[model samples]
Target chain A: MRHGKYRFLLGALTLPLALYGLLVLWPYLQAFYLAFTDWTGVTSEVNLIGIDNFTRMWSDPLFLAALRHNGLMLLAVPLAVIVVALGLAAGTRGTRVYRVVYFFPQLLSVAIIAVLWQFVYTPNSGLLNGLLTGLGLDSWRHSWLAEPDLALWCVIAVLIWSAIGFYVVLFAAAMESVPADIMEAAAIDGAGELTVFRRITLPLIWDSVQVAWIYLGILALDGFALVQIMTVGPGGPDNSTEVMGLTLYRTAFTYSKFGYASAMGVAIFFLSLTLAVLMLKFTRREKVELA
Target chain B: MKTIRHTVLTLWALVFTVPLLWAFMSSVKTDAEIFDSPWQPPATPHFENWSRAWEQASIGRYLGNTVIVVGGSLTLTMLLGALVAYCLARYEFPGNRTIYYTLVAGMLFPVFLALVPLFFVVKQLGMLNTYHGLILVYTAYALPFTVFFLHGFFRALPGAVAEAAFIDGASHAGVFWRVMLPMARPGMVSIGIFNFLGLWNQYLLPKALNTDPDDYVITQGLAALATSRGASSDWSGLFAGLVIAILPVLIAYVFFQRQIRAGLTAGAVR
Candidate 1:
């Protein structure tokens, strides 16, 4: 019986394991080796110059600028998403209607979201500028995606707009799990809504909050598709909205510098891994168990 | 306090819905009206925009391609993922923990890291630019989450049914297929919807692997349309394309709202 069970397990595992190993794990392993070479992705001949690509990336202005933009998004998007999601989740606990509406954006693809926002941010006839001018705040209107200073921030705004709803739904589920009696007791004992939320609700849902933070951080790191679809030159007005993923794409596919691009990919992999681990460590706490 | 909450929630809802509503409205307007009075209702609704996008712009082809790839990938991912997850969940073996953890770790790997090499890998296998290539890649990428979700679900099911089937002289494969799989139906539904929406909306993998215009998925096709015709005088067609691309997803959300929400949050909250 044991021998038959082992044979069955091996048979079931064979195909998926083989596919996963071939497609996913093999490429991941190759990323490290490719990072050291000068392969142009067009030829079989390869020469590995160790750490040269890494050294070049350190002084590369475009890479640094892209890294800076990702850093800014990392700080801004997750913080804004968490705060707004928490507020919405707290304020609309019992309402099913609003939850559905809020989560609507989470359903659309990044490509669709980007295209829709391009119209919203169009300089002359955009809905945003139109609304602003209609409200007599004509001074606030500018080319949102065209300006170097505002372009990355505009992308971050769209990121927040699309992401908040998912976290709102996530936090709402976590909040619903908090025992109602505890919140009611706090209210009766002269605790206000804000106080009860800060004291009771926030602590209870800290686990979900931690996970959401990591998830959003990972998302912030990969603003490639949105930046690809929305921006001019796909990372421009002079690369202001350039991201590592986009930079890597153009470097390998357009410039044929696969080796240099592999270095960038390695950097992104390490950066994301480090960020996720650090977030988990920083946010680690004793699990709050309700009596 | 109650009124304030209602007002805030209502305002947020509007912010989420108005853009989609505006896009749908704009899709049915002429180019001049869309630019002239962007917010106003169309004077005469232009239903030709849909036909134009569907026929002239080739969104219809892209939609069909997306459906095929998503359907094929979703079916394979669920089947392979369920089998592997069931073994890990139910059976004990020497390398069981190792295999399970290895699959879970695949979730941490960002696809961007593997893009360049994966392009070569797929090309080497002669899978690039083919539907099977994209389907296999999508299935491979989706395995981690599918296995993770279903493992928990299979473990939660009562083992009595499978044991009873075995006692009735059913082979192990028969017990798994007949008894165990049906018990995991709800889990399958949740993960199925999740994978369908995800695979349907995938852009980067297809963009990297499948470069042929005829092979373009919905996202790549829409992106091509926007870039090629965005600056041209086809504003209404572009809007119509956006509507067509988003409509199926919106409809799915409406129908499977509960499953979608539960499945999405399951990974984070659990």
Candidate 2:
């Protein structure tokens, strides 16, 4: 009877198990295999030119530019988004209207956000430039998305602005997770609000902050949709906004160099994995202060 | 202090809403009015733009396609994710840890990295450009995160319920579908909302697989409208398309703000 029951359980679980393995594992494994071969994605003729893809990646100026763009985004986008969100969260607590308004952008798709910002960054008749010209600062107005020197920075600004709502909501959620009694106690002990936040609140929600940092780091490297829509994959004027994600995408689909793109994807895969592991390890090392 | 807090949040919220409000208002404005007064509200609101956007851009077709893809993917993913979560949370089988860890590992792997291989795989299956194909890919991609989120909720449930069901001469499947699932509605709802939004907002997967214009989802269609064919001169029509694209998402957000927020937080936390 026990044997029959075990057999039934195995039979029931088999379909789901196979589906998961086939769906997730199979594609990932195939990706690894294709990364090493010169598969142009047209034919089954796979040439195993060992390490050629990787060697080519080292010399690819496009890949390097992509790395640089992502690096700059890493430095700028999350920092800007989070800092503004932190300020918003800190300033607005226990207010219904505040919650509703802060989450407005979370509803927008990347295409919509890109289009909205495209209007804002329009050169002559743009709301931004119109304001600049209206303020008698015509000299200060410049082509925002077209200027190569400032283009990536412009894209970064759009990304930061569009992503602010999510972080504001996240930070607000994390801030709420901090115990009220601890906050009140800090206040009673003659600590200012800023002091209370810096000392008491920050430590308790360190895990949540780490979560945000990790998520943003992944987003930083994997950015594509907005960059593609805003800057057009080649990163206009001179590959200025060519981040790694866009580069890999164009390499695969646009250029049809499937092997080269897969190789780039693998590099990105390891890059994200390394950062995630390092962040998790770093967080794990910190002592959890249980009050 | 309350007044100060309210004022600051309201101001920031206004800043957040301005672009969306602008897009929405511009969608309804006449072309001449859009150029004449970019910031001002239309003297008489033109709701016809919504219909125009729908008809001109063939947004109806795109919306229908999006619904098919998102709905198909959401149902399949939630069922599969909940099953896997149940297995991981309740049963003790050999290789259970291996299965759980492997699923979690897929979460860290970015979708971009798998696009090429996934495309070829879909092509091999002769499913590209079909709703079934796209739905399958989405379900597979979304499964890991859904499983991860649902696992937490399932684990949090008391074991006695399942134990009682098992002792009462119920089959394992009966216990899962009848006893466990009904009780896991909140978790399932949260996962369902997350999958809906993610699949709805998706651009890259559909773009990569479906080159046929008929199969284009709203995101891909809106992008193609704005950049490809519509890049000729005036952007009024393209902006109209953009507004059409985001309207459904906005409506859903307005209606289900709590569920959406909780869904997002649950995915991230797990």
Task: List pairs with backbone clashes in candidate 1.
Answer: none
* TM accuracy, model 1: 0.98
Give lDDT: candidate 1, residue A116: 93
**Candidate 2 overall lDDT versus native:** 0.79
Tens digits of per-residue lDDT for model 1 on A1-291? 233787788789999999999999999999999999999976667899999999999999999999999999999999999999999998888887898889989888898899999889989878898888889999999999999989999999999999999999999999999999999999999998889998999999999999998999999999998999999888998999999999999999999899999999999999999999999999998888887
Q: In candidate 1 chain B, where is summed lDDT lowest over 10 consecutive residues?
A: B224-233
Alpha-carbon deviation at A283 in model 1, angstroms: 1.5
In model 1, the fraction of reference contacts reproduced equals 0.69
Residue A256's lDDT in candidate 2:
92
lDDT of 2 by residue, B24-50 (tens): 777777777777757767788777777
Candidate 1, RMSD to the unseen true structure: 1.3
Task: Identify the leading candidate in terms of lDDT.
Answer: 1
Model 2 lDDT per residue over A103-127, tens place:
7676667766776777777775467
